[model samples]
Target: MPVDQIPIGTFSRITHLSQKALRLYDERGLLVPAARDICTGYRYYTFAQVERGIRIRHLLWLGFGLSEVEAILEARERGDAGTIREHFARRLAETEREIGRLHAIAEVLRTQDPLNGGFRMSITEPVIKDIPATRALSRRERGVYQEAIPRMIGEICAYVYPADGRQPAAKVTGPIMFICHDEEYRETDADIEVALPIAGSVNLDGTAIGVVTLPAGRFASVLHTGPYPGVGKAYERLFAYMNEHRLVPAGPSRELYLNDPAEVPEDELLTEVQFPVEDLPLSP
Candidate 1:
């Protein structure tokens, strides 16, 4: 055979694809032979087919089945660049999201501080501010930490409006840290509430629950990026900052979720960690 011409066997050898797979590709119109021998019905591949064969093999290595590879290659052949671009873009977005979720889970696993091996004091600065009173058509439940939040958020959205529409104006509270106000039991029994904060004159159940007056108080706030489990470290950092500045929390720490978990990237979660503070330097 000429250097420019390659037999199917030669192509298969070079591409590390089985001859059977090459035949399947040809049958599927994925990679057809450049020329066919009239006398023997043999298929002769060109040097160009070698590249396509290699690409098929590569896609297979990446865990794409033959059918998906054919769809992608066919899109390219039809000169539909948009379809190909969209395919890769969607894959990229999915991979990024998976990576973010993995990071978040890992952070959750490694949350225990090696030095202390227990919860310790965390504090921050004092800044006077106002948090408007709001009501939530809220639901409370006790369940697994990871699963409870997302489901409740969904329920709140459902109660407010259509699930298919854009999210209504709202704020998610943190202090996501839950405690047993009644008793200390296993982690499973912890009281968890997902509150949706909304503006004035809100009717959750056609009447006011009560005006939750968020007192005007000083607070030290920090931005925590990534998933909830990763927040322990950020909280630790905040505690260090507070202690270094000689500040004490005047009230319970408040977590204001700045990003929605449903849409925001897991690793890029924006959580504002606000600790009510008493001793903060007065601005000049």
Candidate 2:
């Protein structure tokens, strides 16, 4: 029993670290005891180790892993500022990512509320409208529905607003539209076309965008005002109208984004969901 060595009990009381934790730290070589009685096999700590004990507890409280705490302690002992900074920087980034993930989860939970969720019944009535034919700069791709649509829109904007103040190649006449060519519901690998009508003379000489002349047709249309997920109700209404009026789909359906999503909140987004249709003859 050295005069400098304090029993584990006394050390635990002074440092506020549990005896079990002190023993675990000793086993991990994170903070070894100052001495051990050979006869009793009891551990004792020195006052010099108290600061390190408090530091280890504080680091653990900050959510640092045991391994990370050990590395940080060693770096502090070496007076290596850069190593300490690197560890903190990494932890900060991890915290930010965790925050973002939690926010996404919260949003999902919020949208599940029956009365206040993101969904709403269709407020606008379905109508049969004549959609005029027009030439559009379009890009077709196989991917997730409208997930990659923004990227396609950016590609078109880049050519229209062409790089570095160069003369514009085309004039955008209408809002962005996404055409769904699939006949049935699909989870992935969907056939889609993203297009923007252009009325003025245009040149897509070197651009990957191909010119598409959107066909004129009578479409059953419904304007949906809310998040894209709420558009399902519009489709529900459209199909019901079709069934009641004995109308059949003539061509693929399309979504016309009437306003810039970036400029409006999710609840204010305006999208016209349309399906080309033909009237069924009266049964004799």
Question: Of the candidates shown, which would achieve the greatest lDDT relative to the real structure?
Answer: 2
Q: Could you tally the backbone clashes for each prediction?
A: 2, 0
C-alpha lDDT of all candidate models, in order: 0.63, 0.84
Candidates in order: C-alpha RMSD to true structure: 14.5, 9.8
- Report the CA-based lDDT of candidate 2 relative to the real structure: 0.84
Which residue segments of model 1 deviate by more than 4 Å?
A: 1-144, 164-186, 206-213, 280-284
Q: List model 1 lDDT by residue over 197-226, tens digit each.
A: 555454455422222434456667777666
What's model 2's lDDT at 127? 95
Q: Can you list the residue pairs that collide in candidate 1?
A: 127-218, 127-219
Q: What local lDDT does model 1 show for residue 223?
A: 73
Compute the lDDT of residue 52 as modeled in candidate 2.
91
For 1-284, candidate 2 gives per-residue lDDT tens digits of 67789999999988888999888999999999988999997999887888998899888887799999999999998999999999999788667656755764566467654773446434488999998997899999887553556678789878888689998788778887989899997766888788989978787787889889999999999898876666787888899999999999999999999988689876788999999999988899
Query: What overall lDDT, based on C-alpha atoms, would model 1 receive against the true structure?
Result: 0.63
Model 2 steric clash pairs: none
Cα displacement (Å) at residue 44, model 1: 74
